[model samples]
Target: MSNKKPILAITMGDPAGIGPEIAVKAFSDSAVYNLCRPLLIGSAAIMSRIVKELNSRLKVNSINNVTEAGFQFGEIDVFNLEIHNPEDIKYGQISSTAGDIAFRSVVKAIELAKNGEVDGTVTNPINKKAINNAGHHFSGHTEIYAHYTNTPKYAMLLADEKLKVIHVSTHVSLRKACDLVQKERILDVVQILNEGLKKLGINSPRIGVAGLNPHAGDEGLFGDEEIKEIIPAVKEANERGFIVEGPIPPDTLYALAAGGKFDGCVAMYHDQGHIPFKLMGFVWDDDIGKMKSVKGVNITLGLPIIRTSVDHGTAFEIAGKGIASPEALLYAINYAVKLYNN
Candidate 1:
């Protein structure tokens, strides 16, 4: 793994969504080949269909194992998971079978990394309801990876260029998220984000922690979560010799981060981190009624094996149109390579 190309197990997210299409689009760039050998971990039949649907000339090379992948730029080496009649799961339609296929691919990717078969993993989007309908019962990929890898101290970190963010709690109700924001939880996420920043090449990272309440509790006028929960965490981090800042108003923290004022931000909850970060990454075009572009990469910090994903959703309305943006996937790959190198 030293001074050589790494092999990345790229899960072809739910076939019913734009995962397959965006993956194909990302690989078409060819420059990605110089970074790592990408092994597609999903249905070969579906990859072949996506290739044809996008009018791509690349051949789909179905393989039985990771070593079987040629990893050639002009060819897509699919670690083919033969699902039952994959053709039955049409594009843009949710099905339990599709969810099962997506879940299995991720499971295999984790195995490959744990067994030292691959360097890291880049995941595509999977539908939560579809996965639960398949009986997986996980909120999202972050939870799935944490469960499989036995990583209890994990946080979701979203990175787009210079703007990096981690949530104190994610995949929970807003009320629960508020209640969960104790000093211990904040400290845990702060530590995770600190390590994550270093892995991304930010030495001596300056971190900004967002307040759970408006205006960071407005000096206890809005809420006590900041005074009771957040400030103590920030104090502990400073005492621990980490460059930490905050109970900054959540509204203003992201703007300061976007302006390069801090190395990363600690979001108190999911939407607190996600809303502004997505605003930085996802651009909607009102005139066309579609996304003009999509950006940002989601990294699960505190896992033994590296996992990165596109920040966007399944985009069911535009699944097979061959128009979905692969920008985020490319960023995810770049970040995976960066983490794997470290």
Candidate 2:
């Protein structure tokens, strides 16, 4: 392991959304500089604009390449992709211009990571619709990373201080996610989740696999996915010398995982994992009409290179407001450092 600080290439997500603002906001924290040699992969003009908007002390230093980066505090070292006029991207609006910029940033980051120019990659939120509109038809960061890196099998790992959850199937509808509940898929995710947990410092992970049906199919009374698919996966996992349990009821499993009954969990689908993890991390103040704090890290497991991202989305509602919370991005940066170190 290298004693020197890890170099992290962070993609500023969507210019039309809160990506630029949040990226600048995160840079204001000096702790991130201590953790890694952070380089922002986005337009320096946009970032500079956000810095001015926030009236932050940090300045943006535009660099044509990573080698020219200063990696200094009190300034953002941006691998400036001057592809579009930053003024053209209207906040809170979906446009191909914004999408193209965001897509380019991600592609650039992946290139740098694959070439070993950076130790890992951290991402801000990107709008799926916006990216697709720009002619980039990728679903999300996980898919984008998998495709660009040539990784076939990967799982979305949502983590916080309390519970850690990995999805067996994400970015799919309820119907399709159900159809995906097969012995092979579940076992694959379990292995991914198990390895991810150990890498995150849980050597002996107690994985709780959630059932597909209510009451865990009520012992085949409700649905047979538990009996037919999930059970066999669990049996195979245990037989393979894993500390596995479940086909446990979704509701019961989450509550147990939340209270620390398990080190991590393998969720059946996206919402089954995201809902609980977000509930724990995203705190909203109803009276204030804003989030008090947004916290959670999204890690893409089974990738060739490390990729960690903020667990939230591009809050188009609050884009350019300078009010977007940096808590999640900070957590993500920390996780990126941890993953790189490990």
TM-score of each: 0.98, 0.98
Q: Across residues 1-342, which tens digit of lDDT does each residue of candidate 2 receive?
A: 457899999998998888888888888888898889999999888888888989999878999888998988898999989766666789999888889889999999999999999989999989999899989998899999999999988999999888899988999889999999899989999999998888887879999999988998999999899999999999999999999999899989988988989988898989988998888888999998999988899999999899999988899999977788888888999998888777
Model 1 is weakest, by summed lDDT over 10 consecutive residues, at 1-10
Each model's RMSD to truth, in Å?
A: 1.1, 1.0
| Model 1 lDDT on a 0 to 1 scale | 0.91
Tell me which residue pairs clash in candidate 1. Answer: none
In model 1, which runs have C-alpha deviations exceeding 4 angstroms?
none
Q: Report the C-alpha displacement of residue 261, candidate 1, in angstroms.
A: 1.3
What lDDT, from 0 to 1, does candidate 2 have?
0.90
What is the per-residue lDDT of model 1 for residues 119-170, given as tens digits with 9 covering 90 to 100? Answer: 9999999998888899999999999999999998999999988689999989
Error of 1 at 292 (Å): 1.6
